[model samples]
Each structure stands twice: as C-alpha cells, then as structure tokens.
Target: MFHNSGKLLFFLGKADRLRITVWLFSLTVITIAVPLAFGNLYPTQAERDVMAQTLSNPALTAMVGPVNFETYTIGTMTAHEMVLLTALVVGLMNILFVNRHTRVEEEEGLLELVRSLPTGKGANMMAVFLHILFINLLLVLLISVGLGVLGIESMGWNGSMLYGMVLGGSGIFFAGITAISAQLADNARTSFGIAFAVLMIAYLVRAVGDVSAETLSWFSPLHLSSQAEVYGANHWWTILPLFGVGILLFAVAGYMASLRDLDAGLLRSRAGKTTASSFLGTPTGLALRLQRTGIISWGIAMLLLGASYGSILGDLETFFEGNEILQQMLAGESSASFTEQFLSLLIVVIALIATIPALMSMLKLYKEEKSHRVDLLYAHPLSRFQFFASHLSIAAVQGLVMFLLAFAGLWMAGVAVMTEPFSFLTIVGAGMAYYPALLVMVGVTVLLIGFFPEKSGWVWAYLLYAFIVLYFGGLFEFPEWMEYLSPFGYVPELPNEDMTWLPLILLSMVALVMVTIGFRGYKRRDLQG
Candidate 1:
C-alpha cells in the first residue's frame, strides 16, 4: 500500500517540471552551499575572533541557537545557526508541499479520480510521508557533501552525523506537523495558517528559553535540533527523541487522516455574520477584512521578536568590550560613545525584523491575485485604483503596525530595567523612519504581481535575494549600488545617526510610481488561464 501510494506522490510532484525542480534545487543550494562557502572564507584567526564575539551576545545565541566556539570549526557553527534558520525554510516547504499534495489536491476536485483506483485509506498519508522523506534524505546527503568540501574537519564521524540529523530532522518534524494540519483543516489556507502559527510558537519558545533558560525549550522541536551539541558534546541520544517524536506525530496524523471525511478537517467551519455593515461596502472596508488577521498576526510576532532582542541588549556591551576587532565592527570609532553605537546597532537589528512583515504583506498581495479572488473583488464597482489602493493601504498600515509592536515590546523591556523614559520613543521614531523603503517593497511586490506573474511564482526567490544582498554587503564587500536594491539599504542608520526626511520622500515618490504602473498594467493585461 505504501509503495503504490509513494509512487503517486512522486508523479504528482513532477506536475511542475521546471518550477518544482528549480525550487528544490535552490533550497538545496542555500541549505548547503552558502555555509560551505562561508566556512572557507572565514578561516583566519581574526575572522573567528570576530564571529566568536558576535555569537557571545545573548540575542545572537537566542536567534541562532547554541554555538561550539571552542571547536573553532565553521561547519559546527553553521549547523547551530542553520538548525534554527533552515528549519524555517524547511517548515514552510513541508506546509506548502503537504498541503499541495493532500488538501489542495482534494480542493481541486481530483480526489474522486484517485479514489477510484485500488488504494487504501492510508495512501495519501503514505504518499506525503514518502515525498517528504525523500526530500529530507536528499538534503542531508547534499549538505553533508557540501560541509566536507568546505575543508573544516569535524570531530570524528559524530560531527557529520549530528549536523545531518539535526538539519534533516527539522524537515521531517515539520512534515508531520503539516500532515496533522492537513487533517485538521478543510482548506489549504486554514491548514497553512495553523502550521505556520505552530512554527512561530516553536521559535518563540526556544528564544525565550535561550534568554532565560526556564525549561520552556523542551516543549519545542527547535530545542531538539540545537541539543545535538554539534561539536561540543555531539550528543547522539538527542536524535532519538526527535525521531521518536516525529514518528509518533506521523502515526497520529495517519489516524486522523483515516478518520476525517475527504477534503474535510476535524472542526467544521461555522458561517459567521451574513450581513455586511456600511463599512464593508467600501474598498478599504473589504481590504480591512481581508488583511486585518494577517496584520495582527505579524504585529504580534514583531513585538515578540523585539522583546527577545531587547532582553539581550543590556549584555552586548559586555560581550564585545574585550575584543578590539568586534568593537571596530560594531562601534566603528572610539571617539563616539560606545553605548550609543551599540543601541544604534540594536535599532538596525530590530528594523531588519520589521522588514519581514513588509515583505510578508507584499507577498499577500500576490497571493490575493493568484488565488483568483481579485476578479471577484474587481467585479464589484471597485476601480483598479481602489483595488490597488486597498492592498497598498493594507501593506503600509500593517508595516507601521508591526513597527509599533516592535517598539512597544522594546519599550516594555526598557521599562522593566528602569531605563531612561525617552529611550523607548526614540527607538520608535527610528523604527518608523524606515516606513518609506518598506512601502516601496510593497509596491515592488505589487508590480511583480501585475507585470511578472511567472516570476512571482517563486516565493523563495524573494528570500534568496535578501540573503544574497545581506551576504554581499557584509561578507563579500559589494559596491553600494548593488546593496541599495534591498529595502533595508535605504533605512537610516538609527540611534547613532541623525534622522533624515529626504530619502523617505524620494522613496515614497518611487513607490507611488511603481504602484501606478502596476495598477494600470494589471487593468489592461489579459487574465491568465
């Protein structure tokens, strides 16, 4: 039964011949190649010293998970950091892939055809598991090969094994999560929401525990990935727990899959208010309904991230005080107050966090159009201007909201330590200063939806572009013009530098032009079949 089922999934994934292969290959490269290259580049003693100091900061550890500084091996360090960040990329893949195969297949009205074949109740489960397993195994082998090529020797075979298992386990665990999520929701969107929220919660729990060590980390799979102790202890036993948990989750998911009706979840969705008030008649009103839930969710996430960053800010000075190289990298000049410089770096870090919501909001616009909901929206007397404006309003307002949530979190953390009263508002102002670039990002995404639908199909490209920009700016010494392409480039360096209005105004004008172009082009272009 499992064999036949696996064969079906293998064929189904081949539906997008060029696109799917490219997507997996790209993720494979990112999960493996960048670390290998970085390991080779930073082989010097001075480079290691700078990274050691950076990793010592509490927030860095919280964000990247634990490090094995003593081993001085880049691969081990990469494992620690990639375990957290790669899990994010992998988790999203699992959610999307599983939902595509299971819930989405049924939603498209293809389940009946498949059911007519000689298949059992567990075919779908077996199929999804096999597909995800293949992916995880392939990633493990590719990453191990990449690591070996980097020339950083691991301690015995344990280092390589631990690295592979931790990274691969992340995908396996999330596959199980998506399987359960698929069984719990009728639609792909709802299941994605549930699975993604769990992913966020996992990161948050691990972050909080990293800062406080309150034992809250044990509840999350994230803890398992990092507890492998890559080069430190190379704890072989931890992998068993992750494997055990993933298997149990899959079993439960299989049980639920068998119990649920085709294309249905455990909880039936009840119809809400049938009547639309006067506010719902306006374009903004409808936009609010469509975008409000996402805005609120991102706002809350930013606040939590801000709080996490703030929890470690007080210790950063201590972490970098002894290392002259780190001081130069962080503060730049001794003539200025180191404290002010450190706080400025903190603001830059938080601002980067705030950019995520901006990108997410922009991506939502593409989703709205791709799902074929925009046609219904435009059918109502709403002009193209209204339609475009509605989404732009959502993106701009939500970006601001997320910024404020981050500010609010930082403010609360500051108050707890009885820091200066004005410190919080200053950070908020600095954060708000980046709104123009964020809005431009939203506009860029909108334009992509209209003019380059095929390009927008690759969501991972957005992330990859960002990664390349970041790496080039800091690691490869790229020219300023190339870096300017990233929205983060236009943001004013906060805390340490004075604020400016010129850049913001210019960016706003650019965004307006982009939006105008997208709206006009989309209104005139032929709808895709």
Candidate 2:
C-alpha cells in the first residue's frame, strides 16, 4: 500500500528547494572543509605542539570532545574540531527539517489535505523519515569525498568513511528525538524548543563528562559521534546504537501519532487567561511576553556555556606551567596575566553567541507581520512605533541581561576554581565590551525588516555571514574589509588588547543611526502582511 505513496519523494523535493536546508547543508560542508584545510596548512612541529596543547585543555575538550593528542595528524586534527561542531550543525538540521514537515505542516492545515488524498495514515511520518535518511546519506557521501580529496593520511579512506558515517548517525539520532518532540508538543515552535532543550542538555552532559573524564558522555547521543573514534580506535560498533535508538523512536512516534487526532498533539496544552492583565495591554509588555520563551532558552544556554569556560580558568595556570609553548600561545611576551587574556577572549565568544537571541528578537517584528498576527495586534490602539520599539527594546534588554548572566556564570566558576582572588570588574568589563556589536546586530535585523519586509527571512543569512566572519575569518585569512563588515570586528578584543572606547562609541552611533532609519522606513512602507 505504501509503495504507491509519492509523499516521500515529494517532501524530499520540497526540502531540496528550501533556502534554509540549502544554507544549512552548505554551512555543514564548509564547517568540515575549513577545518580540514587549516589543519593541513601547518604541519611543522611547533604548530603541531601548539595544536596538541590547545586540544589538551579541559575547557576546549569539554566544549569539543577530547582530542587524541598522541595522533595529532591533520586528519585527527580535522576530526577533533569537526566532530562536535558538525554533529551540532547536522542535529539542528534534522530538528528543523523534521519539525517543518510534521508539526508545522499540521499547523498550516496542509497535513489534512495530504491525508485527504489516497494516502496511508503513516505516509507523512514515513516520508519524513525517508527525507531525513536521504539528507544524512548525502552528507555522508559529501564528507567522504571531501576528506578523500584533502588527502589526510591519518584519516585514510576507511577512517574518512567512518567519520562521515558518525556525523550522519548523529543527525539520524536527532531526527528521532525531534520526531518524538513533535508528537509531544502542540505547536511547531514548542516542538523546536523541546527538542533544542534536549539537545542542550545532551551537550552539557557530554561536556561535563569530557571535563571530569567520566562515563556521563556515553549517555548522550551527541557523544556517540565522537565515541566512534573515527581515526584512532575506529570502533564501528558505536554506530549501531544510533540506528537502534532512531528506529525505536520512530516506532514510538508512529504509535503516538495513532493516538492523537490530526492537528493535535499527545501532550495537552495549557489554556490561556480569560482576562488580559493591565501590563499586557502595553506593546512592550506584549513583545516581552511573546519573546519570553526564546529569551529563557538562550539565557540558560549562555549561562551554561559561560560556567563551562569559567570552570576551566583555575586550571589554566597549571596547564600552561609545564609547556612554554602553550604559555606563549595563550599570552604573548607581556606583563598581563594569562588567565585574564583567555577569559577575555572566552567572554567575547559568549557575547557573540548572545547575538542569536538579539537578532531573533529584532526579527520578531517581521515574523509577527509575516504570520498576519501583527494585523490583529494593530487592530487595537498599538502604534507602529510602539510595536517596533517594544520588540527591539526587549531584544536589547534581553541581550544585556543574557550577557550579565554569562559573566555571573564565569565569576561564580572562577571563585569556585581559583584559590587566589578573582576580579569581578574585569569579567564585567569583558561582558560589556560586546554590547556595541550586539546592538549593531539588532540594528541590522531591524534594517532588514524595515527595508525588506517581504524578504525579511534573509536576515538569518546575514546572521550566518556575521557569525562566520567574526569567528573563522582570521583562520581562513579573509580580507580585512570583509571581516570589518561583521559588527564583532569593531568590538575590542578586551583585556587581550587595551580597552579602546573609540570603536565602541562609533559602533554604537552606527547602530543608533541604523535603528532610526529602519524605524522611519518601516513607518513609511505598507505592511507586507
């Protein structure tokens, strides 16, 4: 009966055309390629020694899985960097892909139409599974070919194939997780949150395990990708559990689907209040309420990340003591403390990640309008300025609060780990250093909304562009002007470099101008919705 169902290929075609899918896939490939290319560029003993020491750090290992320092070849170097990050990228892909096809379709009233045709009850789920499977398989093939072309001897053909398979396995595992989350949540957004939260927890588990050198890492499916030991032990058995868990979760999703009515979830949603509160009547309050879920999610993640970085600070001195090479790499021939320099850079990274929420909040204006919800809000006494200002303010305020929490995490961890006195002032300054860049990102998103409401989704592409530029530009030796385009490029590197207020103040002014122009432009244009 299922053989005639064309839903599988149909959805695959649909996914193939989506800009989101295409960009994500391309980013994953770039993530792998960039690291591989860099690893091969410097094969000298000094460079390898530096790489070995960097990978040996507890914090770096906690973030990225422990590297096989004994086998720090280009292949292993590539694997060490790519494993954790690529798994995350591919996992997000599956989560988004699955949610779009399943819960999102049901929400948009398209699932009913699909079902009304001569299709089976399981057609949608089956189609989604097939779609995810194809994506992973294609990713595996791409990575294998890319690695082979790079000619990394340590990760020979077999090791490269295993590496690719491990990545694909992680995606497959998360595809099941998101499938189950979709069944449990009443809406697509809620499903994404549920799955994302689970992903974060899994990541933290692996981080804690890697840092403490414990067995907790084995419990996370995310850890499974790294445990495969692609170039080292080459354990093929590690891949079995991914398939096993995926099949079990798919079966459970199908059973759960059978129990629920179409467009409804297995979990019951809470009913809303009968009367709106006085504060809820205000636009700013309304915006805050709308964005609270995302704020909370990003906030917790940031705190966890910050704390992770902090916990390792106390060990930095010890880790650097024996190795003159690592000490020089971390701190140049300067009078400044090594810990401060590392902490400053780490805080900057946290603040950069905090941009994710800032941009999301700014783009919320476009989202509401695109979904036609803004019209309903505007039906009341809400002015355009109120609508725009409220959301942007929330984003700004939330970014500030998120940065503080991150700094607080660092401070708390520092106090816990350090026997000597820790300076809260330095940490606070580092966190605040990112404010200009954060504001600039929000401003850019607003500009996108104001000028291109119909194509406002393109703001995400801008975010990706900025992220890559700020984080990887130096590694890739990108042109200076191109890197300058990222707001982060203007932000001072903090304690590593002297705190310069000129660029910070100038960037702030630019952000202010951008916001003003966006606000004016949005007022003049007809509502896209």
Residue-level lDDT of model 1, residues 426-490, one tens digit each, is 77887788777767766777677778865654534554565465443444445668757776577
List model 2 lDDT by residue over 1-529, tens digit each: 3543465557656755666466546755674666455554555656665767767777778778887546666666677777778888888878888888889778767788888888888878887887778778878888877776776567688887888888888888889999999999988878999988888888888988888856888888878767777777777888789877876887789778878999788889888899989998899888887777878888888887778778888767656554543353343545667776567557767887777778778777886787577889889887899899899888899889889888888888888988874678878787898898889888887887888776666666766777666555545655769867777777766667788899889989999999999999999999874
Alpha-carbon runs more than 4 Å astray in model 2: 1-12, 15-57, 67-70, 112-120, 211-213, 317-337, 419-422
What TM-score does prediction 2 earn?
0.89
Q: Could you tell me how far off, in angstroms, the CA of residue 519 lies in candidate 2 after the best superposition?
A: 2.7
What is each predicted model's overall lDDT from 0 to 1? 0.69, 0.77
Using Cα atoms with residue i matched to residue i, what is each candidate's TM-score against the true structure? 0.84, 0.89
lDDT for 481 (candidate 1): 82
What does each candidate score in C-alpha RMSD?
3.8, 3.1
